[model samples]
Target: MKLYYMPGACSLSPHIVLRELGLPFELERVDTKSGKTERGADFRALNPKGYVPVLQLDDGRTLTEGPAIVQYLADLAPEARLAPPNGSFERAQLQAWLNYVTSELHKSVGSLFNPSMPAEWRQATQQAIGARFDYLSSRLAGGGFLTGPRFTVADAYLFVVLSWTSHVGLDLARWPALKAFVDRVAARPAVQAALRAEGLA
Candidate 1:
């Protein structure tokens, strides 16, 4: 499998999952702005949406969307317990968290990265993200990962979004549990390997 990604992008979530499962895969660097892969293939030909985190399977199939890709990889190695069993309540809970992180956290933080975004809109987005952090910090205070003691794909997704805090000028320090969550995820060997491989470490 080859994962097309940009350094420090949301693609890092599945990259971390692949490592957690100890699956053999290669990385293909994508220049998002240029819509080109490292080998200069037109990214739009592979994915019309023109985003990072496109996974090309060994069988010549492709997968996009960070949430779906991570879950697919996790299901491939259920023993790793990166996600709960399909059709179970626990799995549904994991999905809920995944949806929240994708829509509420990821989308909001992503918008702030737009240089053309208005200042007032940026301020509102920041405040909205702050509220999300507040709620997530409280949920995290009770827990060991989003769905239980074992880390799930949801945790990986959240970690990638939280990582953008500093880049967008939002301080994780303002929410200690969320701040600690980032550190805890960072200390994981799989995450460390992903970071190092992506030149983010």
Candidate 2:
């Protein structure tokens, strides 16, 4: 397996998942901005989306999309409890959260990352994202993680998305619970490993 990633992007989610699962895979850094690889090969040859978090299987096939990739990697190591078993209520809840993050939070952040976005669309997205963050802040109150009791894939997505707050000058100070959530997740050994792997720690 080869995980293509950009430093501090959504790619970190799958990277953290792989580390948590103790999966043995190779990491291939992708410079998404340049559309090239560390080896100077055209990255478009691997993923036409020109995005990171593309996991190339040993068989030459590659998986795109962060949510899908992390879930696939989690299913490969169920005993690690990275996610709930299929067909369970927890699994449904997890999927719901994943979908919410992907469609709502993730896409909103991605829209803002685009320098070519329409001014009105960008402003609306910023307001929408702020409301979502406040909702998350309330839900996370007095809890250690997103699900309130255990670590799940949602927390990974949440952490990665919330990490973007700094870039937008969105103050996290009011979202004490969410801020604490970031601190708690960062203190985890697996998350630390993920950070160190990316030279963040």
Candidate 3:
């Protein structure tokens, strides 16, 4: 498998999962602005969406979207228990967390990245994100991973999104549980390896 990624981007989630699962894969860095990869291949040909986190499988099939990619990788090694069995109630709960992270938290935090966004909108977005964070803080108050004591694909997704806080000038300190969650996930060997590989550590 080959994972096309942009350093420190959402792709990092699957990248971490790959390492956690001990899967063999190659990494190709994509220059999103230039529409090219490190090997000079046109990225649009691989994923027309023009984004990172594109996973090319052994048979040459490709998978896009961070949530889908991570779940696919996790299911490959069920014994790793990175995700619950499909069609199970726990799996549905995991899906809920993934959806919330992507649709609610990811989108809200991402909107702040647009330099042209108006000040009023940015403030409003921050407040909206704060409310979401409040809920997460409460959910995470038990000091366990989202969904339970065991870490899953949802945790990987959440960790990557929360890592974006600093880049957007949003402080995680306001949410103590979320901040600690970041710290705990960051300390994981797989996550650390991913960070170092991406030049983020």
Candidate 4:
């Protein structure tokens, strides 16, 4: 498998998962602005959506979207238990967390990256994100992963999204539990390997 990624981007989630699963894969750095991969291949040809975190499988099939990619990778190595078994209540809960992180937290935090966004819109977005963070803080205050005591793909996704706080001038310190969550995930060997590989460590 080959994972196309942009350093420190959401792609880092699956990148970390792949490492955690101890799966053999190759990395291709994507220059998002140029729509080109490190090897000079047209990224649009691989994923016309023109984003990072495109996973090319061994048979040459490709997977897009961070949530889907991470879950697919996790299922491939269930013994690692990065995600719950499919069709189970726990799996549904994990899916809920993934959806919340992507649709709510990721989108809100990511919107702040647009330099052309109006000040009013940015303020509103930040306020909206703060509310979401408050809920997450309360849920995580018990001191375990998002779904339970064990870390799952949802935790990997949330960690990547929360890591974006500093880049957007949103301080995680306001949400102590979320801040500690980031610290804990960051200390994981697989996450550390992914970070260094992406030049983010």
TM for every model, in the order presented, reads 0.97, 0.92, 0.99, 0.99
How much lDDT does each candidate structure score? 0.93, 0.86, 0.95, 0.94
Q: Please, what are the lDDT tens digits per residue for candidate 2 over residues 79-132?
A: 988788989998888888889888888888866777788889888888998899
Model 1 worst lDDT window (10 residues): 141-150
User: For model 3, how does the per-residue alpha-carbon lDDT over 1-201 read when each residue is reduced to its tens digit?
Assistant: 999999888999999999999999999999999999999999999999999899999899999999999999999999999999999999999999999999999889988889999999999999999999999999999898999899998999899999999999899988999999999999999999999999999
Better of 2 and 4 by lDDT: 4
Across 104-162, the per-residue lDDT of candidate 4 in tens digits comes to: 99889998899999999999999999999999999999888998899999999999999
> Of 2 and 3, which scores higher on TM-score?
3
lDDT comparison, 3 vs 4, better candidate: 3
Estimate candidate 3's RMSD in Å.
Answer: 0.6
lDDT of 1 at 53: 91
Model 2 residue 32 CA deviation (Å) reads: 1.8
**Model 3, residue 44: C-alpha shift (Å):** 0.3
Q: In candidate 1, what are the lDDT values of residues 1-201, reduced to their tens digit?
A: 999999999999999999999999999999989999999999989899999899999998999999999999999999998988999998999999999999999999988899999899999999998889999989888657887678889999999999998998998888988888899899999999999999999
In model 2, where do residues sit more than 4 Å from their true spots? 115-121
Question: Which residues of candidate 4, in runs, are more than 4 Å off?
Answer: none
